[model samples]
Target: MTAAHCTFFGESNPETVQSMQGCMRKLKLMVPKLRVQKRVKELEFIQHVIEYIRDLELILSEDESYTPHSTQISPISPHLDSTYRP
Candidate 1:
């Protein structure tokens, strides 16, 4: 009895097997770093939102006539650029 293996790259080739194994190892290492970077971005976005809210609160408290169209730019202004009028 014999076992058969098939791949686009020849299955019996040691070089192909080692190259694939190296690629897999590199991908495994990158996955966690990618996750950490994604999480860091999320935290940064949350921080920006918090700061924007704080600025809004300060403006509202300082001026009874505060409006969304006021001159002050937000920390998250890029997101508001499309919807904000002023």
Candidate 2:
């Protein structure tokens, strides 16, 4: 049967069939590369978070002031008391 007659199975013409075949070819070409690209992106994101955490650790370790208000006190103290105070 002609492609036009095959429309009873699905609403597809000759041009639509050709387009679908092209899309399938493109998807076959891209799927593997897309997966690799996604993995690279995830690794980059993890690296960025690791670097950010490292920088944050350095910032927290170094004695610095982060006073937001007059009543605000430093969370980290050089001296640790025997009792834990909230």
Model 2, 1-86: lDDT tens digits are 34343333474777877766565444333233332343445455445445544654555457366433558655643332211121
Q: What residue runs in model 1 are displaced by over 4 Å at the alpha carbon?
A: 1-40, 66-86
Give residue 24's error in model 1 in angstroms: 32
Question: What clash pairs does model 2 have?
Answer: none
For 1-86, candidate 1 gives per-residue lDDT tens digits of 11122232546477767666565444333233332332345455445445545654665577677676789764633433233221
Candidate maximizing lDDT: 1
Q: Which candidate's TM-score is highest?
A: 1
How many clashes in each candidate? 0, 0
- Clash-forming residue pairs, model 1: none
Give all TM-scores, in the order shown. Answer: 0.30, 0.29
Q: What is the lDDT of residue 26 in candidate 1?
A: 42
> What does candidate 2 score on TM?
0.29
Alpha-carbon lDDT, every model: 0.46, 0.45
